[model samples]
Target: MNEANNHVFDTTTGEEQHLSKRNGSSNGTSKNGVANKIPSISEIKAAIPNHCFKSTIKQSMYYVFKDIILIIALYCFGHWVLQCNSIILKTALSPVYWFLQGTLLFAVFVLGHDCNHGSFSSYALLNDCLGTVLHSFVMTPYYPWKISHRHHHNNTGNMDKDEIFYPIRKKDNNKNSFALFFGLGFGWLAYLWRGFGPRQMNHWIPRHAIFAKHVVGCILSIGVVGIWVGILGYYVQLMGMVSLVYHYMIPVFICGCYIVMVTFLHHSDINLPWYSDDNWDSVKGKLSSVDRDYGIFHDVIHTIGTHQVHHLFPIIPHYNLREATTHFRKAFPQLVHINDKSIFPAFTEMFFKYSSQCIVENDAKIHYYK
Candidate 1:
């Protein structure tokens, strides 16, 4: 296992990433090495530059301002679209706003996610403030989700310790698997409220002390949301329930579904494994997930699609995610998982295996998606 100098090259171009030798197959896993024997997460982190770990307040503010302005501009444009003189034109064009606006909302949600990771800015308070507001706008209970997310990263690949996104045990089959697949998009809402998805994470471990400080922030966010709802209610009265549902709720639903699906795919893709304690450690925990490219929308949404690097070094800001991902893939070329075939097709493949092949047998040493 002394693979410190192994060099992995890109299979397609055969280009050298100027990094380590690859450990396994074309897919990234090590055939000779057991699941637990990959390089350590600390080793991976050390390979990344020190500056990747640092953040600047000014740069963070620039992104914050940029996302906010974009969301506002999108909203105003939606309003203008709604006021189109011809009813037919207005009705036809409104969903466009919902899709674009809801996507922007999720864009800022990524910003908040960066804040939650303490990677958005050097100032902890500022990150907290922005994260709380941005997540709240998307109906996420900020502090609660933040603390839970911390648990998730801390124990990403340990099936028992991992807070959310853990797979079902093989013997634990139930009638709900199909239902769960159909409803996967609502996973985020379920995670936040019902404790349904990701195994009702908060119910198992309530971080009371951590949540207390942010209770006021959560409440204030609710108040702000109440105001937004009031505005929506006003529109509902003017536009009717069907119109509101079509233009507002559906778009938001689309965005929420997309977020959760992407999150699910990050960890549950083909060949990734969830380990028992004997086989579990930091490096495998990171390698357990994959990164995706979202094509055109990639940059606008932050480099969140470059998720493997983010999971390993959550402190790396979104602006630096692409660079960090490149460095990591080159360094650990054997360990990095990329979906070059396209996002949706790959998601379809992984998610299908996720439902069918990922069940953990009770007596197995290690479990992976089939």
Candidate 2:
């Protein structure tokens, strides 16, 4: 941790500058109704080429090496910057390094995500091993998250089954719930401790007294992360608390926050739709997610913004997602939704969705955000 930098991020105002300007949208209003009929899962799968589903160890390792090297390099750079003697230089430059450090770790999150889906490598053992390592660094329980995330994909648009972000009738929504929308940017912390999002757990931290689904895995992950904390303890002992806090703790917290915000923006927006029973189609469910641009950080975060395509075909590796999305859009133009606009508008979109647009009324049979 860099002792020169210290503080948490204020996401209330939000990262308006992080959003990119996009060109198109998916606007199917309730009044207009949804597709006369829903497409089958196989039909949707056929839309994407077979090659998109393939993964190779050589290619996967390349990305793993690339992302790991970049994360290490960013930390190294931050450490050097903190060594400057001038107070003015340290104050101004240190935050930039911290931001870059946090952002790079967000890329690490993408790699872990790929492993979660078994998309990072062809070998299951390799994927699990890498996933454990990457997830431990960021303090995520790999097995628990992987299982719940499966639930999310299985019942994506269903009003009831969808694990997280499941919508209630407009009258049923908690209008006064500030904590609900707070996760838009800072939700990762709340989620880490008290499970939120599409995860299966009702509470973030499970009770050990009862029979928890992944107790052994969760305990193991905690122990693994404890090792990381122990490493930080070594640094704190060497340079005092300030150094560890600034260089690692604060920045890494920001990294988790970044993951939450990015995930939030993709799935939680005004234009996207949620469905129930006959209304829910596999293709539409996948298309319901929006893909935003993070400007230059798009590559830094491993093109996670290419989300709609990723959801449709989770087998596609992160490094290949951008190219796959291009083919996806060309194949199903009407099914694609893109909002590569800046975070400012996305913030407004989220604000409106959470504030006034809290529920699904009789307004749409498809059950979209009001």
C-alpha RMSD by candidate, in order: 4.8, 9.2
Q: Which ten residues in a row have the lowest lDDT in candidate 2?
A: 1-10
> Which stretches in model 1 have alpha-carbon errors above 4 Å?
1-29, 32-37, 85-92, 170-174, 180-185, 201-247
Could you give candidate 1's per-residue lDDT for residues 246-346 as a string of tens digits? 55676667678768777876776545668876667876786667677788878878877888888888999988887787778657666755554477676
lDDT of 1: 0.68
Q: Judged by lDDT, which candidate is best?
A: 1
**TM-score for each predicted model, relative to the true structure:** 0.81, 0.82
Off by over 4 Å in 2: 1-33, 169-176, 179-186, 197-213, 361-365
**Global lDDT of model 2:** 0.66
TM-score of 2: 0.82
The Cα error of candidate 1 at residue 247, in Å, is 5.5
Error of 2 at 217 (Å): 2.9
Candidate 2, residue 113: lDDT: 85
